[model samples]
Target: MRIRGLTVTFGEKRVLDGFSLDLPDQGVTALSGPSGCGKTTLLRVLAGLQRPEAGRVEGLKPEEAVLLFQENRLFPWRTVEQHLTDVAALSGGMARRLALVRALALGAQGCRWLLLDEPFTGVDQRRAEGLMEAVRGLRVPVLLCAHESHTLSLADRVVPLEGPPLRRREGEGP
Candidate 1:
């Protein structure tokens, strides 16, 4: 997706200012920054969960993308299989079981463009890698917010955010 002259504010804090980015049509892009740097806010804007005060975004369809928030957001009482069925509407039988397997492997399923926030949370390196592999298997655009360098490295391109005005660099380390 392409964003131009984007601005977002939360109360008195200007999370993003005059930010712009052009994402590739395919492949993963990693967003990295220190805490409270507006990376998550940017993702929300991109996902259409939050609105920007002023900006223009093109080439993204709201219905086709799925966002995985920083928190798991899984229903506390729902089993893993139930969660996938709830979101993707895959009922019992081979389809539901396959979706659950995919989600368990990648930690999410059925999203064309997966927006993952801190995907590695509460998981070991091996499990995280398994999840990452599942994400790779989807062969879709993946946007990730990451604190670890190794996790960021898995992305096709890494964008590092610094301060307000939301400067971005391609293939840079935070």
Candidate 2:
């Protein structure tokens, strides 16, 4: 999506202020920023959850995107297999792996894009690597927000954010 003059305000606090950005046609692009800098907000915008007061976003629709948050979206009582059959068939050891299996399954469902917010927060290094690889093999594009350097390496590019709400800083590639 192409964002022009995007503004998100909560009461008087500006969450996003006249921000502008462009999501590429394909590939992974990681977004990094300090706390409360609007990285998650940006993902919500892409997911059509929160609307900017003034902005024009081209080439994005809620239906075309999926926002996978860090917290589990699964039911504690329901086996991963019940929600998704493929998760059941992911060889063994799925009991210890959640991020990789879930991500692979979601990406396999087919969508225009996925906005992942630190999808591997609780996962181990080894498991996170496998998840990153699984995410890498996805057919759709991904925009990720992660703090782990190892995990961030999985992205095709990085957009390091700074300032309140966030403005893309220089020195980071496009």
Candidate 3:
């Protein structure tokens, strides 16, 4: 998807000012920046949770995308298996491999673009790496925001933000 001259503001402060970006139709693009650089805002806009003040976004829709927030929204009372079963209803009952379950049934939800915010939080680095590899293997495109070096490494491209964004850090080839 492509965002052209997107702008967002709150009160007197500006969050995204004529901000723009182009996310790939396939593979992963990691949005990297400091604590308050509008990464989450951009994700929200892509997920239809927020509307931009100006410009246009193309190539994706609300139904075509899913945004995984920085916090784990899983029900604490539910077991991992239970959560997996619940998700299976969305992902077409894809078989289980390892326990890395976040990306499990999202595909079945018809989510073409997986937008994640610090998806590996609380997970160990080793496990996070494995799960990221699995996500990379999926045919669907991915757009995520993270600061971890490992997560950044997993992306097919990295959009390093400094203000209005900058050039993309091309990953080690697709």
Candidate 4:
């Protein structure tokens, strides 16, 4: 996907100021950055959940991308077999893992891109790696946000970001 001159400003904080990025046609691409640096905002914009003030995203449709948010948004009452049950019954890490699995399953159905926002936040490193292996096997492309260096390393490409007016780190673009 190609994002050109994206500008999203929330009050006084300009989350994305003329930000642009080119996502590869295949494989996993991870966005690595500090907190409040617009990583989540960028993913939200890509998923069409948050509209940008300016710019356009090419080659991706809202319906074609599935966003797995930073928090596992599983319902507490629903019991979807082994993958999901009562939300209170599972640990934080277990919930996050289950959420990942569910998102992957949904994304595989017809989605073109799997956009994940810190999907491994509560999961351990070992288990996170295992989950990443599963992600790498997907036929569709992926754009995910990751804070851990190890997690970023698992991606085929990593885009390091910075600033309240988020921008790709100098000399770090594909």
Predicted model with the maximum TM-score: 4
What tens digits encode model 3's per-residue C-alpha lDDT throughout 54-112? 87788988778777766555555666678777742222112222223555467545668
* Candidate 4: tens digits of C-alpha lDDT, residues 59-168: 99989998998988876555556443332367789888888988888887789999999988888889988998888777789999999887887888898898888988
Which structure among the candidates has the greatest lDDT? 4
Query: Candidate 4: lDDT of 28?
Result: 91
Per-residue alpha-carbon lDDT of candidate 2 for residues 16-51, written as tens digits (9 for 90 to 100): 898898888688888877767888887888788898
lDDT minimum window of 10 residues, candidate 3 = 90-99
TM-score of each: 0.79, 0.83, 0.80, 0.91
Question: Weakest 10 consecutive residues, lDDT, candidate 4?
Answer: 79-88
TM-score: model 2 vs. ground truth: 0.83
Model 1 alpha-carbon drift over 4 Å, by segment:
88-111, 169-174
Q: What is the C-alpha lDDT of each candidate?
A: 0.70, 0.75, 0.70, 0.87
Off by over 4 Å in 2: 85-100, 170-174
Query: Model 3, residue 7: what's the lDDT?
Result: 79
Superposed Cα deviation of residue 73, candidate 1 (Å): 1.0
Clashes of 1: 0
Model 1: per-residue Cα lDDT over 41-72, one tens digit each: 88798778998999888877656676667755
In candidate 3, position 148 carries an lDDT of 84
lDDT of 1: 0.70
| Candidate 3 lDDT for residue 16 | 79
